[model samples]
Target: MQSSLPPPSRGRGRATRERSTVPRSVSAHQEAVRSLLQAPLSAAGPAAELPLARARGLVLARDVTAPVSLPPFANSQMDGFAVRSADLAAGRPLPVAEPVPAGADPGPLRPGWAAPVMTGAKMPAGADAVVPVERADPPRFPDASAAAEVLLPQTAPGTYVREPGSDIAAGARALPAGTVLGPAQLGLLAALGLTTAPVRDAPAPRVLLVATGDEVVAPGTALPEGKIFDANGTILHAALAEAGVEVVDGGLVPDDPGVLRQLIREYAPSVDLVLTTGGVSMGAYEVVRQAMADQPVDFLSVAMQPGGPQGIGTVDGTAFLGFPGNPVSALVSFEMFLRPALSELRGLPQPRPVVRARLAERTDSPPNKHQVRRGVYAEGTVRLVGGPGSHLVSALAASNALVHIPEGRGAVEAGEDVTAWLL
Candidate 1:
């Protein structure tokens, strides 16, 4: 006969009480972080005056009104002569009084004669139509005495003349506030005689990235047994830069609680957001969790492989996040959470591209977990290039997309339909 062992102690609950805190479930923690990160921003000050050349990708802060009508005045659209329809009714040669070569004032036009005008040339006063040089029968010459006078064979009123204000009216709202400035917008501003554009001031957020691990070595250093090189810092730095973030790489902080605490105390107050990798699990030496023990942090174990662990909180109003240590896990976590949060703060749309593709091979995913498998999408089919191991770098390189397999799903047979989010 065997004796029954005493009931196990509820150490987890006791530990929570001892620390006066509890680890929030994955969903609850994710929701809390999402809410804080996507909070509405307060209204900013008036628009900034930026040079038109430097205003690309910025939102206009105020409405721009045209100062004057487009074309400024009635102009000739063809290179020919400007004359009244009555002058051509006689079907006789008309003398050219003056020349209007685009930007040159031809002075007032006499009622019974024609003025030689070039395309874009301002029509002389009292002129009502423009006869193209090609349409005139024997085009006229500069000197009336030495010229073969042309007959206006076609006499149509208001023909070949661009009326003033036809394209845009004076004092009209050219572009409303919040208009995203692009090449077309810049061209419109230039056409409206505006040398400067009113654009929203870019909000630059300073970010601090801290990559933590004991087994992680710098990229240039030699790797020992069970040790790997760090890539998250470089990858995340580039990603943040592309997203318009100003990042200062805080470098690696090993899984040492005292050092981690010191770094956080020093850098947390200086940055708008603090990002880290590794040390948020229930391991005995989880430095990130240990360091923030005195501070506010919500630990979460999400229902996702390779990126299941996360921590989010604030240290004196500065936002902080801890992601898993695996390279793919870190990137995937960022794509799902941080990127969207930052885009929301910057008033820009999220960058996830979704499309449907047929699976090229059989695949299976665990129940109640969203499996984001990397694969290559081609010819309307997605080929799984690598195993679902997060540490597989070659697999990551071979894939260009993440196939989102929903929870509680089983094997996906070949040629089965699935949705993929392009990276």
Candidate 2:
């Protein structure tokens, strides 16, 4: 029978009734993987330039310097007359010169004259102020043949003029290294006229996924006696995809240890990591544990409920992570341990969003196990969705957060503060 007792603490000896037997803290397990993995398994190559359109969600490997100042030259910000501020100091009518439409380079402003400059047009030389069309007496462009003059109000220098380098300075850093390219970042690159950006060469990590157990069968197929659909494989594949990792399905392996070993050997060379669900716990059909018994892997129970049985080791130079078979346990294990580590390696955000909230009702936890309970968190309160069973796939789906109860703290009262991980 599977042991109900918690495993021994990682660094400490045996587990006692008073002390929790957590083999590793959530952080410790993540750190171990970081230290053990020498190179990123999914790396494509060295950093190289990528088109701006294809750079979204990629990290910038180098700083991007502005080739030219934003608004490269002085331009007009309003469709109005560009006049020397000194000439309009006393609100006097000035002769209108040739109109400067956007994209046209009109001659420099004639002394004692106004030039009709459209918005976004380059400011004519010797012009420092703009009088909006509405602010003019007739509020309309004068005829060039008529050589009309219009009255203007006193104006200050630099008004309505977009000065050179106002948005970004030339040769200045537009984006620093390690910036994750998003809409705003891509827009900036496009505005700067850059066709490509230097991004990290890391490709999405490739994983070989294996599901074990003779009693498990594929979904949408006929159900034989004492058989369950293979939920773990589907759940894990979806989770991996959502995390930006690539998965190569190894299909379902039966309880035979020799066949499991042969399957691992076949896929290990092509993948960066190997992830297997089921057969790592203290059960008669624990094929994964028995097959890897002679290898360097360590199969141990963590002091965490729903996902206590865990394994981390390398098989033929490929790292392998073993997760519990229960649907909820498998999903929670990925969220708590594998997700954070993989995200960090992929230059994505770490430690999924966590928030504090009050408990909606009383809850019980095992004496020496940290319990991750699925719950619906809203309006500053978190309510448990279902019982503490690890097979409650329906309840897990209904939850939007995971409420964490620390080990050795048996029960929590209603209205008490608790930590929750947002999904």
Model 2: weakest 10-residue lDDT segment is 1-10
Candidate 1 lDDT over 132-180, as tens digits, reads: 8877766544554464456776578889999999989999999987677
Q: Which candidate is the best by lDDT?
A: 2
State each model's C-alpha RMSD to the native. Answer: 9.7, 6.2
Listed in order, each prediction's TM-score against the native is 0.68, 0.75
Candidate 2 lDDT over 352-380, as tens digits, reads: 67789999999999977779999999998
Candidate 1 C-alpha error for residue 224, in Å: 3.4
| Model 1 vs. true fold: TM | 0.68
Alpha carbon deviation, residue 304, candidate 2 (Å): 2.0
Q: What root-mean-square deviation over C-alphas does model 2 reach?
A: 6.2
